[model samples]
Target: MSLRTRLQGRFQLMAAALVTVVQLPPVLWLCWLTRTPLPALAALGVSWPYLKQLQSPWTTTPRAPSTYVALGWWSACLVFDVLMLPALLAIRAGTPADATWGLAGAVALLLGGDAVLGRPRLRRRTVRIAGLPPELDGYRIGQLSDVHCGPHVPEEKVAGWVSRLNGLGLDLVTVTGDLITHGSSHVEAVARALGGLRAKDGAYVSMGNHDYFTDGEQLVRELERNGLHVLRNRGVVVRRGEARLYVAGVDDTWTSRHDLSRALAARPEGSPTVLLAHDPDLFPQAVERGVELTLSGHTHGGQLGVPGIRRLSLARVITEWTAGLYRRGRSWLYVNRGAGTTGPPVRLGAPPELAVITLRRE
Candidate 1:
């Protein structure tokens, strides 16, 4: 091979190896950490690095999309270990002990129990939001978030969700990014699946971090082609009779390229505006700009639990307003539990959710 060709091949190999390391090594350590009654010290040693690895989703050479949901389970198992080990160890050892048999037991339960019993659950929520205006009261907006469509996400399930969204009789349907996993891989399929969803105003979306990681622009067009009106750093005014509701969306903040200012730049004055941001962290900017309602779905509401042992899961850290409606002074933020899973395909306390949100002038 020529020198340049050899160099190119080497680059490909390195990239492939890095992806595999990111996706596989922690998983092996996690299995070992939970398989035995490891001490607290060993527990910590095994888990800390796994925690870091979860943030990077690539595994294998060039990160091939697995046909099964094993990675998703693997991801959730690690999260479970993080929450369960510390407490169970503290209880079993009668104090905060080092990685010991007790600690290992807890870690194992988190990893194994969820793997065995956990099922992907979906929740449909409807809320009649009050206190908008006479004209804008009773505006129904269907919200779908975090539909990370790819390998493990059953194709029929996705198409079903879109059908359900359409049945809600919504004035508008909004997606807050994460519509697909490998954005270019199955986003077009997702678009086709969602081709049935129709709302009066339109369908809108904001880009999520995962979408940016994959192919974002193509995903956007695919959704548009499916008749879902997606918005990215843009706004559109919808008129329901005499009422006007300005809907805008901001790109994900974690990817560090979100421009909130631009997203709301075209927001209409004297209109009840709703911001559809993929990540809840953008609420501050929305509140500062006097946005009324902001919808989000990045956190999965502590995806798993041990039934009363842990109050909530570590998924909470991904968003301050993890999985509920919170009012930041004059602005309201509703973080959806999400329509799909990220790493682990299992969900526990926080069920995957779709929302039929209505706006009313209180």
Candidate 2:
């Protein structure tokens, strides 16, 4: 077998082992307390199919649409199982088991059901840049990111997003990496799907950490071949009438070298520039460089957020600018929640987004 296949097998085994370690114990403990294996068996039955599906190579096969839903529910079970651990402990201390189980089940059902219902949505944000060129005012840029196209996220899903993007009549399109989950194996297919995207200045992409894991160079080449421009520490001048806007893209800071200075070095002083960097962590660097706007992805808006919490997402733990818009001085940043998922094949409050950013002169 190939090295990748061997690695895949080992990873699957490791994941299965980890899941068992986390999930099997609670079920077993509950069973031991209740003197029955039914609960444990039921939990295993609910989660087994998803674990089985994980063994398959993500890039090699097309998954059934329902596979994502099943996996989402399975993920909810795992999450609730963990969340209920404290209550389970309380059960030993005289708390009622019925109430604990009911609450856990209810929360899990709501969370998982919400994820399945999270349709890809177009979120429109208008950014007012203080130094934005008058001619570039009302410029609509379509931004997409973190399209983890593979088994869990099928081609049809991506095609649908592309169709939506085509309807926007955008001036420019930018995709901020994580194009595929696995590697170069699915690059062509993803390229083909993304090839449908068209804009006035065409589509521009910056590599992400996952893209690096999936063979970054090959991904860049495939995207370029499919007519999507790969911006690797490079700058392009986009013109509208007599107005000029400099667009630059940096390599992923998580897995690759990123030189914001190099990417924006050649741009004329005080000209409006948009920087495409994969991670939002690099927004400070872009701001320092006087980039008018920076676009990023990779957080997926944390994929889960508490319902009543305002502007709170799981991504907040890792990134300050998880989703939507944030401003620093004269520079602005917009984080796209992404079009696809990586691990659980689900999204909770943070739905998949096709962000339409309209630039306005302040």
Candidate 3:
């Protein structure tokens, strides 16, 4: 095999081993504390269908049963680490056990409910752009990102998102990558479902890191075949009466296919522009390029957050521009929390989002 392929294989093995190590200890501890093997046995039973995923994280299709088990296990572990463990420590330190357990239970239930039952909601935001053409001032764009369609995220869910976006009467629609979870198996189905998106200027897409995990080229072809424009380091211009708007997209940055300079090379100078990049880390570069607005969605808003706080999320550890809107100078960035899930198929405080952004003249 090629060196790159070999390296990828080795990396997947290491990741699988790491996840196994991290996930095993909590279950073992639970069994020990409970003085029974039932917990351990039950964990094994639930994980059995997904055992192949441990060794090959990117190869297996996620099913509902395994998906639920994975979500439940992740929630349990999170509760244990964040709440249960602390409560147990307090109980050992002469604290009242009743109060501690009660609080832990309440918080756990709240978190669990939000993770499993929360649905994607519509988010509306208006961006003021300097030099925006009067004709283009009220331009509306609908964004759906990271809709990881596969076994876990069914095609039906994607179709529903498309229907909702269509109802918004957007001028343009953009999907900022992570179109499928891993393999090429679901690419056609996802593309077909997303084909239902309706907009005056049509839908545009950008590649994300996860899209490259399998056959990135095939995904691109499928998306294009279904009438979606996959912008790979390129752009297109749309006109609104006398005004012109330039829309462009670059490939996934993680795979090094992104070429911001090339993507913007064909743009008419000083024309209002919007860029679709999968990773928000490219925001700084986009701002430097004078992009009026950059849309992105790779962080998934950390897939968890505090209810009242938008900035506080697990994604903050990876990026300051975790979710929502960010600005620097005259440029703006809006990172969608995405319309689907990956890994455990669970969402908490940071629910999935379908963003309808309106651009107005400054």
**Highest-TM-score candidate:** 3
Each model's Cα RMSD? 8.3, 5.5, 3.7
Q: After superposition, how far is residue 143 of candidate 3 from its true place, in Å?
A: 0.3
* Best by the lDDT measure: 3
What lDDT does the true structure give each of the candidates? 0.66, 0.78, 0.82
Candidate 2: give the clashing pairs.
302-315
The reply for model 2, stretches above 4 Å from the true place, is 1-34, 37-113, 308-312
Residue 116, model 2: lDDT of 48
User: lDDT by residue for model 3 over 226-316, one digit each (tens)?
Assistant: 8999999999998889888999999988768999999999899879899999999999999888998999999888776665466777788
Per model, how many backbone clashes are there? Answer: 23, 1, 0
What is the per-residue lDDT of model 2 for residues 148-190, given as tens digits with 9 covering 90 to 100? 8877677788888898998989999999988998755678888
In candidate 3, which residue ranges exceed 4 Å CA deviation? 1-29, 36-51, 62-70, 76-113
Q: For residues 1-362, could you state the per-residue lDDT of candidate 1 as single tens digits? A: 75435534544554344334333544556567688534334434444443443343422112333312335434544454455546555675655445465666565555543433233334444434455667666777888878887765756777788888887688888888777765356767777886677887777777887676456777778778877777778888888777678888887675566788887888777777889898888888888998988998887665554433334655554555767677867688888767787654665556567787777655
For model 2 the TM-score comes to: 0.79
TM-score between model 1 and native: 0.69
